[model samples]
Target chain A: MRLAAVLLFLATISAICHTDGYIEQVTQQIHLLRPRSGAAGYRLKDVDCLSWRLAVETNNVRNWKLVPEECEQYVGHYMLGKQYRKDCEIVAHSAIEYAKSLTLVGDGKDIWIFDIDETTLSNLPYYARSDVQFGALPYNDTKFNEWVAEGAAPPVPGSLRLYQTLLPLGFKIVFLTGTAERFKDIRISNLKAAGYYTWEQLILKGEADQGTSALVYKSKKRTELVDSGYRILGNLGDQWSDILGDNSGNRTFKVPDPMYYIS
Target chain B: MRLAAVLLFLATISAICHTDGYIEQVTQQIHLLRPRSGAAGYRLKDVDCLSWRLAVETNNVRNWKLVPEECEQYVGHYMLGKQYRKDCEIVAHSAIEYAKSLTLVGDGKDIWIFDIDETTLSNLPYYARSDVQFGALPYNDTKFNEWVAEGAAPPVPGSLRLYQTLLPLGFKIVFLTGTAERFKDIRISNLKAAGYYTWEQLILKGEADQGTSALVYKSKKRTELVDSGYRILGNLGDQWSDILGDNSGNRTFKVPDPMYYIS
Candidate 1:
């Protein structure tokens, strides 16, 4: 009986040790790597708060005040309109600052290429409206341009400050996107709504190039920029593709994208 | 200054939120998937205690009783050795009990596969000597087989009982390893030293033309087992690959490998 009891005890211990339930193992591995004080338990509380906020945003209640039309206008005016609205003014300023920052002494002129989606526009409101966190959806170009043309987009944080700083600096801004050129009217109208009027070029993927991978499309856009006699100063985007152009730029800055993938 | 302080305070809170990091993300994903957490964190105290004890045994100083030819054997025999001695006696008895419990099929042929490393012999002594937690250096096959033939492996908790029980119940035992066949003699010797001499086969990698990919090699091993006309009743290993046969299995039992990758 004593032996049996001992065996049972050993069995119990072994069961506890061996199971690969992932959480315990992961927690253990992390703890092994970085010992944390008891205070680390409070991290759960933070997680709870974040999860609650996300849940609230995604729920049936329209409490976050998602102004899609305003958002579009905000994106268009600042990204293109060159106006100095308090919230949406960064795009124009950064464009000018960036222009001056470039010293293209060689035969190649400098091009400032940008990514679409979160880089140029604020899309958290749209995510809030759709109640989706990471799901893929089609671009409603008509509605998007309509909103942009209205100049209703609230300025994205840190964007206008940089844009305003860049533009007066003498670098010609170029907008490159995977959005097909078939949506040129809406795209242009959207930028105009946001106050974007002129640029060296605003290149979008053609209709025949719709289903190709974003990397391939973006590479092609860089080639176009190069052909246009511009040495890329720096590419700015939320995604890796924008910054990964061949010999296009000397530096790359990535802004955080809290919502949506262009790919 | 007051406004700046407030802005800093808000920024601190926001930064804290972002730093919540990968743990929260993985936990949230797990919760969303709703997997059975069955027997996972169920025995946390025991798991912690066991891991702690192992750490102590590996680290303790006065425990050094053997040095020269048996320096390796000394650690294995005394620390893990004693544990195995206890396990073998218990498991031998339990194997009989387990054998009675099994309902043998009409085929009257059953096979038991054991994962090497932590599953059978004490591989920890090798790692313990080097104080390296990660990489396993290439095996010294001749030396390993000699050690194995010497019959000096410590028993993992609960393993002997299971192995013992299954043997008498008409189950043939085999040791299958991702370790190459060059070490087969040492491996066999090692098993014999541990009182596990009934192994019908010692299957190793690169022997029967199965390449190094974990998925492919394990599946190939299973094909050999099935072709031999024996039903795989239960598989024991320290990795997911050991039991998840070329993507099929009957019953799977796993042990923890705190040292290195078995797959």
Candidate 2:
């Protein structure tokens, strides 16, 4: 009975934790690693949402307009859930190990590319809003950009940790994003406020490249980067589009994101 | 008390089900869809194994020789668990949807590719053995080949369904496996026995490709298929090497396999 009581308390806290993960994340600067003190009650029976996420992560399902309507709560719970953080942590762990494995050239041409939105910062706070419905609701660029303009997005703990770790490892960082050039100021502030201090380049989508598909625009930018003599040693993103195109670095790591599909 | 008793009974059966999943799989010819008749208890605290699997599934971790020793039970439970089937089901769902959307050519040139082990045919019965340790043990070729020679593998229900679905949808089926040509006859018997009745081509690795890596060997084979005028519309595999590199199909579906990895 005591065990059940404790589990109930933990389950209650666990439920509340993921729902408000970003609040604690932004205000508290916590990593969202663990929700409570004990093993909480959760089941793998929510296989539908789990399946949707797996398909999204592996790029088997693309251009999904909205998450399955039935999976709104599941997606919310997952986005705010412990597993998402763990998935991101494993990716960070892999990136750190890979970054450490290389012998850096003294010339500082070795670079690591990071996709900005879900890779460097989490938009969970915005995505969890009543209007957003964890992306089951229609996407409004205006609403999203307003959230971006507010500069309240928190650093994705795993990615921020990777960013910090890469600084001392002799890999120059590049922040690549699909966010347009107009929001560059706000994005920079958001990044800095969220702990990203510097980068060799912050390439946002400029007007000149407007209307280009993410795959093509990103591919061209990467090609230009490679032609400029910077060797991309590692690339990290939440989208397959970030890591799939040419000049895709030596190795690519995908941080989990199921809130929305960009391509 | 009645609910608790029912739960306990279900739990017992669930435990027995996954441990002996392959036995039932091979003997019953039933899709391992649901494990039993109730809501079985499982906690998601096995985060490490879950994370390792996500990393593997997303191709973040590659070239792993064996499952992490700590994750043996977790991997076993996952591979034999309901989620594995559900994951594969989602992939198949996506493949079916994608295949339906495409306009197939009437020339018999439109084809779908399938990989053998852990893709079209499941090696779970062998991988779940005491010697295999659910892939925690170092791979033994002689032992694995012995299992393959028995010609007793089951079809991955999702892939088999996709194979069947594709055939009537006007898509030719092409089996492209890394298994050596010497085992071709056994593989054919295994495929036929497992419900894959006919295929446009069954390509096994020949002596000329013995020294090649899985990626290079598979790329060369796919190039040959393409050069011969086949347009690969869909390709399904359990390994990243199966769907990446030159001449990768128009779309690829990765079925869940955490037991072993091939680069």
Best by TM-score: 2
lDDT for residue A237 in candidate 1, whole number 0-100: 67
Local distance difference test values of all predictions, in order: 0.46, 0.77
Which whole-number lDDT from 0 to 100 does residue A20 have in model 2? 28
Error of 1 at A114 (Å): 36
Model 1 accuracy (lDDT, Cα): 0.46
Q: What residue runs in model 1 are displaced by over 4 Å at the alpha carbon?
A: A1-263, B1-101, B106-108, B133-152, B208-210
What is the C-alpha DockQ of each candidate?
0.01, 0.60
TM-score of chain A of 2: 0.81
Q: Candidate 2 on B1-263: residue-level lDDT in tens?
A: 58557547645743321223111111111111111221221123344887888898999886555465457678888888888999998898888888887888869999999988889999899988866767655556678788889999998968888888898999998999888889999999999999999989999988787756677888999999999999999999988889998888999889888887666
lDDT of 1 by residue, B180-217 (tens): 66666766777766667676778877645433444457
